[model samples]
Target: MFLALKEVGQSKIRYTLISLIMIAILFLVFFITGLANGLSFADSSSLQNLKTDYIVTNEEADGAVINSTLSEDQLKTIEEQLNQQSTPFSLTISAVEDKQGKEVNVAYFSVDTEKYSDIEIIEGKNISELTGNEVIINENIKNHGYELNDIIVDKISDTPMKIAGFSKNQTYTFLPVIYADFDLGMSNIYGDEPSYNAVLYTGEKVDISGFDTLTKNEAVKSIPGYTETQGSLMMMVVFLFIISAFVSTVFFFIITIQKLNQFGILKAVGADTKYIAKSIFIQVILLTTIGLSLSGLAIYGITQLLPGEMPFKISPTLMLGTAGLFLVLNLLGSLLSVYKVAKIDALEAIGRVE
Candidate 1:
């Protein structure tokens, strides 16, 4: 450790340049990771916010809520069979016209108010208190110029509803969510048919014939484009890791080659191969720590500057996990330089082999 510090102190410029490269690489990795998480949350915040452990969808729908349909009778049977408290809700992706006649895309969540009054109202009255054609909307809809008591008309049904409240993080499939009463919404949207897309249960899994039970994770995966988007972003993160490893290996290997004569002299003076290898490992760890710390600060600043609508989120767990993984990869990469140092012949390195 002492030798490594001394070397870095003597070659501050070179070490600083290497650290800068690492910082840039780590910052990009962290930024992309945050975006991946943010997009996921924005796409399914409504479902993610639910405390339920599992969801029931029609077997024919193959676990996808959008494709599933359950009548009031089927929901009662499932409730009796499972003997658990459940929430029934229906979803539809459609557009509603604001008071100004401007169309705004929305994900309508028609829920049974008595059974599921979990939609938190950040402003105005709760959905349960709403009577007549009143709906609660996601706070994000405020970006589109809607406010409490504003009137929005359903383009399809020509039914006008008043915005009763605003809720936070209530989005579905990247669209702002609007919560409505089940009886009123189903009658208007589905022509007097009392049906729901799925049922949310708050207990262990139980198999019910003709219906498919999906865990939270399974249901999340079933969201359209969710798997594909996450896979692509994750692939980019993996590639960045590979690039960081390659950069670390080459940088340290070159440095080791440049200092062979000095290493030979040290070995002759009783400095062992283990000491030299430890120096390389210590250098890698030090540089990685500095890079990761700076990258974290940089990401925090960037998130602050980003707009609220931008899908960018940061979690401490992700940051720490990424930093730990980066440190490990860099250590593994430095092994090549360590191996080269171990193979050095003290006599030949000092030009005394002849």
Candidate 2:
């Protein structure tokens, strides 16, 4: 370790160059990872945040909540069969016009406020406390200049709804959500008759005939583009990991070759192969630690500076997992260099330059 630090200090520019390269590669990995997580959250947060365990949909809808419909008879049968209280909610895509006449797309979630209101209000009154056309919405809609007590017109129904409050992290299909009273939403947005898109079930198992049950996570896949988008971004992240390993391996392998003569001299002076290998290990550890730390900080700053509309989230689990994976890859990549150092013949390597 002492010798490794001495060498790095003496060859500051070389070590710095390699460290910079590591930082660049790691920065790209972290940024893309955060972007992927953010987009996934944006795509399914509305359902993810729901407290229910499974969603009961009409078997004919093929597990799609948007396409599912449960009549009053089916709802009663399901409640009785399961012998539990189930909350019926409806979700649909709609648009609202801001005061400036600009249209912003939104997912309208109509929940029975008295039965199940899982939305966490960040501002204003709770939806349960409101009536008629009053609604609570995702706080992100504030970005469109709509705020507490502001009125936004529903594009489809042409009904002006008051923004009673705002909730955080509520979205579906990459569109911010608006939570409305179940009965009122049916009258204004859906229709005059009472109907629901799906029922929220919190039971362990559901086997009712004529109905398909999906876990909350499984239901997110039913959202359009959720699977395809996640798969594509995840593939890019996997390739980046491969590239990091390759870059680290080649860089250290070449460096090891250049230091053969020095390694031979050290061995001739009584240093063992284990001692030499430890030096390479120490150097790799030091470089990776410094590089990943700096990259994490840089990515955090970039996420903060990014536009609010741009979906980007950074979580501690992701950062730690990424850093841990990177460190392991770099350590494994340096094994070739360690093996080269271990096999150096003191006499042959020393005489090569002569």
- Once all C-alphas are superposed, what RMSD does model 2 give against the true structure? 1.8
Overall lDDT per candidate, in order of appearance: 0.86, 0.86
The segments of candidate 1 whose C-alpha lies over 4 angstroms from its true place after superposition are 98-101, 186-192
Minimum summed lDDT over a 10-residue window in model 2 is located at 183-192
> In angstroms, how far off is 274's CA in candidate 2?
1.3
Over 1-354, each residue of candidate 1 has an lDDT whose tens digit, in order, gives 999999999999999999999999999999999999999999888887765788899998876788888887998888888897788878887788765678888888887677775666799878668788788889988877888998888777777888889998888887888888876664347566765888887777899998999987788788888899999999998999999889988998999999999999999889999999999999999999999999999999999899989999879999999999999999999999989988988888998957
Q: Estimate each model's TM-score.
A: 0.92, 0.95
lDDT of 2: 0.86
Clashing pairs in 2: none
Which prediction has the highest TM-score against the true structure? 2
User: What stretches of model 2 exceed 4 Å from their correct place?
Assistant: 186-192, 352-354
